[model samples]
Target chain A: MGGPDYAELCQLYARYAAALDAARWDEWPEFFVEDCLYKLIPRENHERGFPLATLMFESKGMLQDRVYGIRETLFHDPYYQRHVIGAPLIHAATAERITCEANYAVLRTKLSELPTVFSLGRYIDEVVVTDGGLKFASKLVVYDNELIANSIIYPI
Target chain B: MDGAEAVFPDEMTWPAGDVGRVPFLAYTNPEFHKAELERFFYRDHWCYVGLEAEIPEPGDFIRTAVGERSVIVVRDDEGAINVVENVCAHRGVQFCRERHGNRLDQGFTCPYHQWKYTLQGDLRGVPFLRGLKRDGQVQGGMPPDFKTSDHGLNKLKVATRGGVIFASFDPDVESLEDFLGPEMLGYFDRLFDGRMLKILGYNRQRIPGNWKLMQENIKDPYHPGLLHTWFVTFGLWRADNKSELKMDAHHRHAAMISTRGQAAAAAPAEVTQVSSFKASMQLNDARFLDIVPEPWWKGPTAVMMTLFPSVILQQQVNSVSTRHIQPRGHGAFDFVWTHFGFEDDDEAMTQRRLRQANLFGPAGFVSADDGEVIELSQMGFEQKPFHRTVAELGGRDAADSDHMITETLIRGMYGYWRKVMGL
Candidate 1:
């Protein structure tokens, strides 16, 4: 429904990442379609065929659950994050779907620790465009950092 | 148990070639372990630090602890990986405090007092005057105690092969290839294939066991059938006939790999287990399955090898990565696992890989069994209360192994261990 091309579909991505980086969670889920798949995982376990990930969600509700978990439930350092998204390149495209690949890095400044890189990865995204602009059918974050110093939380 | 040198039967004495069961002290004692860290591990031995793929750009950095010493391995301005001690030259405050980054213009700066250094660990500048800057004579200036040149980060010997960075506390350590050797390195290169990597994901776990326990677990294939009922009961792995073979190296490093096949039928009655969970029947559709649709009975399906002391090489189908471990205490360890794929992996392929990626970490059905079992072993071994545990399982001689159940590889490790620990 929007520009009906690659850059438009990708602009929606950079916007979504920027908003989430800004803690605009209310606007975060709007970028995803009804059945969205998202997983934030480290590289070590994945090589050994291990599926335990930092964040694993199969739908928009799961993404919302993660947001809720951070806000209401689990304990983490009260911090702020800003995601810097690189230019996205289209990997593939179909009549209804567009696949975009972009490099992403997040800087999270916590209470005591110095502002450090929270997460860095390649965003392998599949989006479907409808009347509601572009929606994420799935987003897989493949983290570049092998040694995760402490626990990793929040979306990147 | 306290400072009492381990006493045992002549057979119990280790690094000596023998099939007799060795004492458990070799596995449990802090003195013995300290020796291993200092001699074999820290001295003239290669340790996997981080992946070479991590520092992709000039000035990219990752801070990690090799042994207890914090190390900052950063890609310098020229895009070459430089492994330096994380401890700064001036104060003890660590530079590159965060996990990973790119210090483009300004080099690494200390968090505490603002002492700055380049990626190569040179003392670039100081905050104020020589001392605290009184009447042109500052108090507490650069210490006469140690000069900046005299206090460059304690540099360790580092080398790389297969896109994995390895470092040793000892500069005299053998080159990476010589340390790994042709037989072992050849098998390792299969996973490395030398293509640009696309990271899949990562996971971490803390197991209640010595770091060596993890090394032994990956090298000992017997545990797969005996321990991983989650995979077996779910029809994940049927024992293949003599498919699992053990290859031992001089440094106590070993590779345990299983060729694809069904176990020699009628080998053991307990090998097969009945399933209790209904969902077990559903194929998880994880990435390992994505590579080969049918059961693997001909080619090698899984390869698990250790890079000595602290890291593991895991190859499951087309997904490859490393599992690095840091021993927290005599009975504690922090485990890290990384996932990677060729850059050419398609979006659909990447998704299938993520879904099928389940086996060896904390949540892995196959590897989750390990944490429970590792603790049980630790508890059982500790029951001897500073006494030694027995490691000879399949044979009596060190390095003598057959049919996957042998702890001889462990004894071979102890041999190298004693040589390093100078026991």
Candidate 2:
């Protein structure tokens, strides 16, 4: 295939954000390939090569497990999260994969209070073109701020 | 006086030294928080600062807090570790601002006035001592009566046990091993078995609750099966498992240990059959839940050990971590979690620990509910400060237990808290 369309890849990012913002958690794993990695790590850990991540999923199956657990087992305060995704900065594009970076801010509204910026981070993604268009082979959500307020129950 | 009479009449008070009865005011009162910082933190307790592995080389330093005072733990030229106040003696400004760094040849230089100090916290030089600038221009300087030797950074008593460092403001405080007690020391040594630690990462969480609540959470072994349904629903923890609450002789330190028994593996099916335990979930990658047993640890599968004032050594399933509780105020505290692994861990072993990380950090499936519950408990105090929380699960006394369903450890922690705070 020819070089993946940058506009189409940006649209894929928009779709992923909307799914999470809508709390359509069941659809989250569909954004990634069958064998993929998704990790939400602090920038300090990312820079220092620390092995731990706040949220680490080595495969799409693990991502599905997280969604299932959060929906079924875990109990957290009732809150709604809205993810604002910025434009993607495409680094390299090929027939098989594409590397891109995008900035994001998550605003959470709980108990009808004002929406607060819960977390701000940049998404470093490795995208692949499959039968379903662009799917993330690897996505690293590196949060800029280290101090997490209360807990991060929902995905960022 | 009637039984309902106020304990202290005017000021806030504890009702008859009952470990089960914890007044909500203790968590919300500002006066109590101040007293705790003075009596429990500064005067009496040995607070865990950092790991010796963090500053292995000379001049390597990491800044931390002992209650509210900023402290710096550095390695001197001769490889001895020193703990000193981060405040500059000249102007009382914080000198070492970074969280951690290497100052190999050059010693700590005050960022504000260019005052210099050796790694051992001795006053080395002042930039313009005799009012002579770098260009040899004479200007105003310190008064002649000011002695440079007496103005060195204030040092604290430092101690290391199994590579973990602890510092105390009071030099006369008990030795590290004695403070931890023999029982706790054994478990502490088991956790930190002299293996070089590789910092996996950190999950720093700011909870809107009293610091004691965090400690109590670790001490209360009864809450896991009830509060965190993920543990029960996923067969990771069971109420009928072989678990116990072990306290030190003074009841100041405690460890809640849970071993995975054969019966524990079957508990999920039995629990899920009941309406309360039924939850719609299944792990696609169940390998993450597998516990690759460490050869050294012959104890329980899970252990949450509390070191009195502010440190917690935890081995939840396969994840090993230390939590440093920094009290922000009466109503809030920060849980600085340092996740670690043995330096000799193979690739698969490291990945297993990293994969299991989802089980217990700030955003962890099992740990996420704790922050919420603690915050909710803190919020409850705003409406009812005079109300008391009942910790009468296993009677009022604080002692060791053979069962997981007990509040003995929580009471033991508060018992220690009451003694240290002189309540």
Candidate 3:
């Protein structure tokens, strides 16, 4: 099955990672369609078929609310996050949608501390070609680690 | 400063038995941590294990910890739940590695040596104990005095109440009812209420701070309005809200009860003055604040209970959970959140519980700040071991309060800590 060009899909993931790593949270929802699902869940629950997720946004509106929270509501020590994401492996594709998965490692560095491996996960995503551009229809971040650090300040 | 050294030793000091001031050494000293584990966790205290819903069928088990020591909570053939140490009695190995599984009828077996035990942790089979025959003669047989019953796994005293479970290392410890006392037991029953529990899911985070800090965080109502923007802006928790602080007779267990007030367009000067409060903040998806009150809540919209050394029972609006504080050492602890719902809840109620849960857990909108502050607080305590923290929000004494503006619960906890630790 063929949808968008492989290079275009690669560019979409690259830009998404770049935006997240830079903490450009406002640009996050733009990567997804107006109606989308974004979930960051531990693999433990995911494998058990449990619905609980570390962070779940059922709609793009919910994603925007989280952005508002990070920008205006939440109080946390400022830190920098870097994402090292692997190439996306497309599983299936149609004229309207594409299914793929990619591995990711997020490294975080606090102002006074050294860098640490904050999270290790893989993204299972559904991409669709909208009039604007290729956007995520659904993205499920399944983290391999059972225990998270003190908190997940930003989206993985 | 004149008689500071005389009244207090160099290792640790408190101001004449006053619970208001807590020493930094309490969170930094390794030796003191061991004493706390012995006095507060291992003896006389019933630590929260897991919900009965976790192991519904025979042979179902979940591997957990009782103050850092691995243990298994399983269901036996008789349908009675048992709490057994995960250690192999022979080689002293923690045999169970999986966090959860079904033991079925086979029970547990140590890998190093095929020493088998029943679901109740009784020694059932011992390979080669009777010895195998070699040609014409038997070799390496156990002595006639060997008895499997004498070599069974260490069994913990177990208690079950309204689907919740607790276990203790001390057999003579008080019963679960007496341990919680009347006031605390009423609050416990409000949440548990004999209703069947449905396990939603779990969230585990390693907080780099003392385990007691997690308890103190829930106990101290002063920080919720000041530190959590989501709580303050959304009116989930406020300084002026109708609230009350209640503690057990021993002051080791506590409950913070609060009823959410009307959301006013113009907030009071006191609340608006807080750094975390945002008057104009709003959720794009208003469903997060779509709180549907349950009959169990009675009047209060939220009730956070700290059950001494082990767990925190939470009933925050539509979301209810158990926060288990498993200490690793003086410096760190594992905070496990078990978000559950009543078995009678409908699909809509379950979804509401799940959505409202966004306000908690490690990455929660309100709770993430808690984990961060506890970590930073531990750092401060470690940096200056001689320094002490001031917990004189409402007053210098620890007592039940009628408002949410006090640190009385923290003081009360340290009051119990001082008595138990003898420091």
Measured by lDDT, the strongest candidate is: 3
Evaluated with TM-score, which candidate comes out highest? 3
| Model 3: residues with Cα > 4 Å off, grouped in runs | B1-10
lDDT for each residue of candidate 3 in B1-423, tens digit (9 for 90 to 100): 533443334678576779988988888889999999998889989999999998999989999888988899999888999999999999999999999889986899999898999999999989889888989788886787999999999999999999998999999999999999999999999999999999888999999999989999999898887788677787676678888999999999999999988865547767656865667767778888888988888889999999999999999899899999899999999999999998899999998998888888988999998999999999888777777899999998989999988999999999889988887
| lDDT digits (tens) for residues B340-410 of candidate 1 | 76667777666555545544455444565576567667766765544455665766556534366566666
Q: Write the per-residue lDDT of candidate 2 for residues A1-156, one digit (tens) a residue.
A: 367887899899999999999999988999999899999998888987886899999888988888877887677888999889999998888898999999999999998678888999999999998999889999999998789988998777
Leading candidate by DockQ: 2
Q: Write the per-residue lDDT of candidate 2 for residues B1-423, one digit (tens) a residue.
A: 323655333466677678888888789889999999988789767998988878888989989888878899999888999999999998999978898888879889998888999888889898767776666676777788877899899999998877788999998898888888899888898889888987788888899999989889998878888778777777777777888788888897899888876623446555334345754446788867867888867968888899878889989867988999899989998888888888889888888888888888889988989999999999887667767798999798888999977899888878877777777
* Candidate 2 CAPRI-style tier: high
- Candidate 3: deviation at residue B241, Å? 0.7
- A best-first ranking of the candidates according to their TM-score comes to 3, 2, 1
Q: C-alpha displacement of B262 in model 3, angstroms?
A: 0.6
Candidate 2, TM-score of its B chain: 0.93
* Per-candidate RMSD, Å: 10.9, 2.8, 1.9
TM-score of each: 0.68, 0.95, 0.97
Segments of candidate 2 deviating more than 4 angstroms = B1-10, B133-139, B263-265, B268-276, B279-281
lDDT of 1 by residue, A1-156 (tens): 233675686578678877977888767767888678776666544444545465556767656644543444223336688788888888777778887778888888876768888678788888887788888898888777754434454567
